[model samples]
Target: MSPAFNLETCARPNILALEPYRCARDDYKDDGSNVLLDANENAYGPPLADAVSLTSAAADAGLDLLGLHRYPDPHQGDLKEQLCALRNTHAHTAQTLTPANLFVGVGSDEAVDALLRCFCVPGRDRILVCPPTYGMYGVSAQVNDVGLVKVPLTPAPEFGIDVPAVLAALDAAVAAPDYDVKVVYLCSPGNPTGAALRKDDIAAVLGHATFNGIVVVDEAYVDFVADQRTASLAEWVLEWPNLVVMQTLSKAFGMAGIRLGAAFCAAPVARLLNALKAPYNIASPTSTLARSVLGPAGLAAMQANRAKLVAQRERLIEALPQIPGVGRLRGGTDSNFLLYEMLNSSGEPDNAVALAVYTKLAEQRGVVVRFRGKEHGCLGCLRITVGTEDEVSRFLEALAKTLAEVRQ
Candidate 1:
């Protein structure tokens, strides 16, 4: 059994103890009943669009001109309500999420940084990251002026977390002289790997009796998983106060530009994040677009889109290995992306050929795939995002051509 977790003790003594800046929006509801002079917003609404009436198409897609002059709902109560409702449908827990359980940020990056800053004292404390995972976690660690503890995922085929090594590291630092691990950042359907971590492995880390740190599980591409309800650990947050599950509309909803991401955790943690963030971090337009996408109609649209990508991703998995220079499809096919290797003459992974294929595909054929040959255990690999049928077809064709040329 794990030791009892305490947010008060885990947080940086001085930094995380915060009193939130209550804005105008926080004082009163904007329920169209009382409008007024509080937040310094312009009384005159934003200038009307030139000669363009609100079209049926705009209304149908839930697109609109937001009140640009006024500040966005700082609490974002409505958007959080929609998000909680959506996650609750897939959640296995009886504990339903409320607005208090979520902290909306500009992107998942903001949450990552906030977690690091609130918990980790720069230069003295650190965060743990499994490499061949998201780059942003490490980037955020550095940007926060905190140190990083790296325990790479067990090599390719599985690319699973090395829980033993992680526990050992955490245990070793428990009574260390300096620099304790304050957070553990995990990526499910891992950024480049496209691999989902096993639930038990994560649970082991969370249940570590000696380690008293936040375990952040980034489920950014969770929707792309074949069975997201089973794959997501979102519901686990209800049971584990130290857990924070991050999700975004960027992957499945196809709304990356909206710059909205959420951290679903216990209420106290959520409160800490809310207090720590900018007063108006999520813009009105961003909030509007997010609400539209997360609504019932937009959700249906997203499901339809996700179905198409899953089909295409499966097709690539089957067909990609047939090419002369292509090797095994690395990791799990748990995301809208695939990580596969480029083969050399002797049929081993080849970084030179992989780089060439990546460069030629973008420069000559107008297809783009990420080259991540330098990452640990990812030799001669390209991370290809699953695109539309035509786009995937073009990528496969372009890849085959490029590989043949590079090999020769």
Candidate 2:
């Protein structure tokens, strides 16, 4: 029989079919500093940096030491406590959604694996992915032994969410006798494509998944969204209990090196994800640095960087059409990247030609950009991230030269 909840109905019976991972309070709790015998850390590792150096050093000096002598917090208490303030959730009565409702991983990548491990059963469960989106979703699902259902977005429709197709897929899953759909994943300000799913579209998916399954909204690029319109289904997790909002500090915060991302969901979902994560997922230095970046001053600087990137993105879009062989510019409603197609004399789509142009600019002109072909629904396109004014100018110069050479 199909389960009562849509998420459960879509999951592997043996997986969502079972209780979530649970750890004893004492098991997760921290007990002072010395004699860390909990998770079997290396007896000796890198030495810790001085407090003074850690506090006011330049970026290079700040990241100098590892000090992996002791295992960092498994539950990530201090980091979560700090992020709670930054996220600014509603007031709680008994216990304001503690660190338990939060799971910090090496990056959003680990969190993706943890979530799949928690719910997916090998060879029985499947995940649905929208094309021209982040590839990690499909990759993680496959690595975890879960099936993948491809639902390509209609490029003709501005690559908007295929509401009807998604709804039909849900209907089909519900009709199946034994199949269970656990989670539906969506990426906003989606990668490569840079298309931001609308609020209404996200709400529709959330509402549909609420009764039967879980909806995971990946807001990895939310920080780059113009006007900050990216969905915050984080709070919805409190009310709906079936929503999981994942975010990363890699992009806007310029903390990609620190490698930290978070998953915000109801306490139950968070607990399950937390339990499935590695005991010591975060490093001591990473936790400390993440905390520092989430502070008021650091956050302001991050926002300023985002604004600069957006401006650069606009400039690129405006300039692309003027260049011959470039058909039309796409993407960048939200996010720092933009995509545009380059056509050959025959009017045929040729991403390889575009990639060659990209390489020439990078190798000969010293300008680097991402080359994302039409494989994931982005035919004959180039994905370029916004850089500084000087960098953008250099890119335009390099691009013009490459186009002239390609024409010849």
RMSD of each: 1.9, 4.3
TM-score of each: 0.95, 0.85
Candidate 2: segments with Cα more than 4 A from true spot: 1-67, 89-98, 209-211, 229-231, 346-349
Across residues 255-328, which tens digit of lDDT does each residue of candidate 1 receive? 89889999999888898888888889998778888998888888999999999999998899989988999998
lDDT of 1 at 80: 96
Find the 10 residues in a row with the least total lDDT in model 2. 88-97
Note the Cα lDDT for every prediction shown: 0.86, 0.71
Candidate 1 ranges beyond 4 A from true positions: 1-4, 31-35, 48-66, 89-91
lDDT of 2 by residue, 1-408 (tens): 112454444444454445534334345564545565655556565444456465346346444344456656566778898766655445222234556668888888887777777776678766777787787888899887888777776673267778878877877776776655567788877777677777677666666732376778888887776555223445556655677778888988899998999988778677667656666678878887898888888888888887888888888878877877776666655777788777776666588778888788788888888777755666778888888989888888888779778756
Per-residue error at 160 for model 2, in Å? 1.7
Highest lDDT model number? 1
